[model samples]
Target: MFLKRIVLSLFCFHVVLGKTPEIREDVRKFPDGFLFGVASASYQVEGAWDEDGKSESIWDHDTHKIPSPIDDMSTGDIADDSYHLYKRDVEMVREMGVDFYRISLSWTRIMPTSFPDKINQAGVDYYNNLINELLKHNIKPMITLFHWDMPQKLQEMGGWTNPNIVDWYGDYVRTAYELFGDRVKYWITINEPTQICLYGYGLNLLAPRLNIPGVADYLCSKNLLLAHARAYHIYDEEFRASQGGNISITLSAQWYEPESELYATASREYLQFDSGVYAHPIFSKEGDWPSIVKEKVARKSAEQGFARSRLPDFTPEEIEYVRGTSDFFGLNHYSSYFVNMDEDTINSYAVPSRADDIGVNVFKLNEWVLSEFSSTDYVPWGFYKLLNYFREEYDNPPIFITENGFGTYYTGLDDDERVTYYRGYIGAVLDAIDDGTNIIGYTAWCLMDNFEWTKGYTVRYGIYHVDFESPNRTRTPRKSAFVYKEIVRTRSLDIGFEPDTSVMTIDEGH
Candidate 1:
């Protein structure tokens, strides 16, 4: 009888295992016109924080003034030193064989005074060199106007929460359009509003740390949406006709699933708070806050004795203005979480945080091997599910995966785990396209390791690992870099194909 029971258990295990999807190379190749690229932000990669007439950004101020927030207490003051090494950086991109490169403009560098009255020639010359280098190599340039590095001068008056930033950001976008729009065809207006609002203002995890939770984050959200719409309109009306470019605001979303069938509503609530609140405003058929977000936040605020909802309202005109502003659904997805409705979860403090507002306890899967900065479980299916959700809810808008990659603290040359992660994620993207999602492009999170904000230099997310301790911040191509290069070159994934070791080289600024 015991033997029979063991046999039954083995049968069930085999059945369950067989049902799980595996990352195999047998799938159809990615569709034609699917772009492959790599992404990096200005403050994260570009050093020279105070060089060539560059003013201090919020990141510069935060890392210098309050280094405690960063894990290693390191600043981007000399990060990668891309300011001086941009030619080498572009050479690395050219070697990778990517179709394009996504980079952000440093707001403070362009307009040190945070006004258009004085345009810095040095900053203009620097971008021109970088853009020209990419163009010379046949690599298209996709520029992001802002990536959480606001000029400190602007933040002093009040950053995104001030409402006046809509115009301030508009002026900045117009300046960028005027300067580089002819050379750059793809424009990402802003990168991850949720991170800027919730993490920076509400949680105080990033630059210009406000930590105001319920009030500041919501205010920032409203203003950010307005600012994005204003920029999109500026480009569409003024620049698009001449330059023929596309504009979008990237939103970083983590796929959320219910901890169990019982917590389905909790998962949905978590999703609404994380990405829906931001996406619904610009992407939904009817612009404005997601109904669930409005209702839940209002209920929570009422419970906390607030006279009105913590989330600021959008006027009818404002909603219409913001609606359909995005040309493509620019997404920056990293990982996934399992959420459960739990009241006893810690709220950081007694005050209502974004997590507290949602009242959901989020957890990583126990099966996922936790690295210094990654989840080894690497659920690519979550990405597939996310794309399907967008298709069903947001009317199948054109999507560009603006940023996606794995990170680790280890600087090992053989990053087999990263290769596997990319294989699975990119495969899932292909699956989504076959399943009718309008995904246009995919850009790996970073071209090389640089300053990782609050985590400082602890976490590395680049295919080409940067030796931060080196005088030149040497670039070493890991095995994943070779794998990525092959994938980009072939325009197809072949799991059995081994990368050529010859492609892995140590860049000593040669």
Candidate 2:
């Protein structure tokens, strides 16, 4: 145990030290039956938008129209060229010993105008070929229905804020069921509604960048959840009879803590708004918005001179539609921190008056309550707490560690820090599983590094590194890939298997 700690420290230090860990690989200790997988999204990797009878999505317009918004001014123009090289992608997934491949369907790709007045055969062929290819290799295809890239037309139609979107989304879900539901057994309704509503509508950081007054984000939040529930309802009542698949939502969360013992009172309210408002309605036993959120939104709406509460009201029918819409919870976790609870103290920030739910003044383990923009606190144990919280709260609904990985500040094939990040984070997941959390699978954040939203390609999150300088978008496996590959292959971390520090291997691709 002491040796592992030293190795972990040395791994982090190696990023700057330019030296390597001397540990042996056989010493790894991951357990058996731990499933492994890699993930990618439609907009991030598929580049032939205009070629396949597919219409543009909001991301296409956002990334291309304002290239300057991205740090490297890089767009997903050719991004890994996965739309064409997906067979190679399947090869990589098979080689990695990963049991599942998680990918999202592009709304614009299938239903050109975001509506199914016409089903694009070419668009259907794209996913159809990809899905069958995965099955050929005995790899399970895990499909995410929507991953933030809403149809461009939908954006003009008020996107998620417009209540009509609930029906529009249901149509899309039903179409997907008709097309690929036969082979694909797992489905995710939405990636992260909080990110879409809070960042896109509140911070103006994502698609359909509309920082509308009270009506933008809150309405978007309500409609997004309703859309998810509506889609699930259609699948359950209309499609499940023949399809027989699992549907769930992938939620993003940052574990919150109070900055100080004295500040605990204040931080809880912040979390209740940011995390609770978004999650409680779906996960709570009674399936209604938390009392704090209902009261707060009502008071804020009244102060803003609105006749009705800005937050959309759920009809009894809508609540039931939104309630229990998940077969499992898809959790995308990365980091956490304690937060400053004092509202007045937090109000001093130059944050937009519209954004409170963002949980400003977060106290990372580094002892700084920085904003989420800069908080990369490393707390693996937080995931254990998270899994336990859900296990107890939601009556042990199954969980998939949908997305968990560390963001990097440096680059190299020898990603010791990433290995450490995976080791600790996944170790925490294993711990939760031991304590009886119904976590059945784990999928890392991404397969190859690709366009990262506003941050662009500057942040690297892939186990397999992609060279942006190369026109070919060449992918090279980082040392961490070997670490992860072994975990996938053996379904155990051979704390015993050391980094292949032997200078070089004569046998290539063995």
Candidate 3:
């Protein structure tokens, strides 16, 4: 035990020192059944958008519309061409020797018109093929029902802000459960409700972009939570016993540290807005929204001279329905920020959005080293701290890290930064697990680079680099892919081992 602490201390020091240090792989290995997997979203990876009778997703409509919002003005119309090339994807997963593969279902693909009557047989067959392929390769499937690819029909009816979306989502998810629930054992109802509510609605960033700012986001939040809860109960009531599956919602959280002790409250408020608002209603024992979120949004709405509140309130029965819905906290964490009080900006009303509700200015930590890829800082310790925050604040629920990885704008095979980042973060996960955080799994953000939403293909977060320029969308395994494959294969963080991506070989487990 003393030696373990010494090894852990050395690993932390190596992270802080920004230098390679000698370490024992077996000592640093994750616990048994600690799922080392990779994730991919439907719209991002699956092309053949119009093929197989699939209708237009909001992403399909948004990226094609005039004044495109994507960074490269690129669309996921062709994406990684995984729709036609899924066999290759399965081969890659098999090569990785991972325990599971996290994949999302496209709502438009399943029910193109967003109605119960029109079940796209081709779309259903495609997913069946994909799931069966994964299962054939001995890779467990972790399926996400919605990864922000709302059917354009649903978006036309006011998207998430429409109260009817609760039923709409319920019907769509129920259809999914009935069709695919037999094989899929791990289910994610929604992926990052905060992103859907805040980025897509509050800010005009994502698809079905509505720049309604403060008002649209709150309405969407309430509806989104209800949608997730309703789906969970549907699974619990109709599918759980027979399907034997676990259901949860994925929430993206970037750890925030106070810029100074003075801004500690601001940091806490950042948490309230970013994660607490979405998670509190479902995960917290007391249900309802976070007290800080409800109080602040109400106060801000009143200040803006709104009747009632911009943030909607949940009825008592609704709160009860939403609580205790998750079997695990599906977390998608990537980076960290240092937050400080910015009252002057908060008072100015130059821009009235979700940012104003928290009344804080956020920046990256001082010590973080930036890469050429994205503005994300490499602070693995932040992950450890974030896990502890959940452990203490949210009653230590079982956790599955659905997405955590490094992103770079460059598409290079030699991603030493990503390798180091993974090592440090995986080490941090082990540290958090040792400290009593109920974390069960850790999935790398991606299996290969795909169309990264608004950023399009500007940033690459995958261990395998996809040649978007190539007609075939050839996926070449990067050094990081080899490293990850080794980790998953060995179930240990073998820091000293160097992987050779030049050759292909499955682990002994395969």
Runs off by more than 4 Å, candidate 1: 1-20, 346-349, 370-377, 504-510
Most lDDT-accurate candidate: 3
**Candidate 1 C-alpha error for residue 89, in Å:** 0.9
Q: Can you write out model 3's per-residue Cα lDDT over 1-510, one digit (the tens) per residue?
A: 557545534433333233322323654767887888899999999998899889998899999987778889999999999989999998888889998999999988888788988999999999999999999877889999999999888788898999999999999999999999999999999999888988899888887789888889899999999999999999999999999999999999988776555555566667878998988898888899877777887898788788877788899999999999999999999888877666675676434577877777887754676554544578877788788778867889999999998888777899988898888888888878878899999999899999999889888899889998899999889998988888877787778879876797865454
**Better candidate number, 2 or 3, judged by TM-score:** 3
lDDT of 2 by residue, 345-459 (tens): 5676433233443334665565331223222445766666666666765789888878887666455677767777788777777767777888888998788887777767777
Which window of ten consecutive residues has the lowest lDDT sum in model 3?
A: 15-24
- For each candidate, the alpha-carbon lDDT, in order, equals 0.84, 0.74, 0.85
Question: Which is better, 2 or 3, measured by lDDT?
Answer: 3
TM-score, candidate number 1: 0.93
- The CA lDDT at 231 in model 2 is 78
lDDT of 1 by residue, 264-353 (tens): 666666777889888998998888997768887899889989999999899999999999998999999888777776666745434666
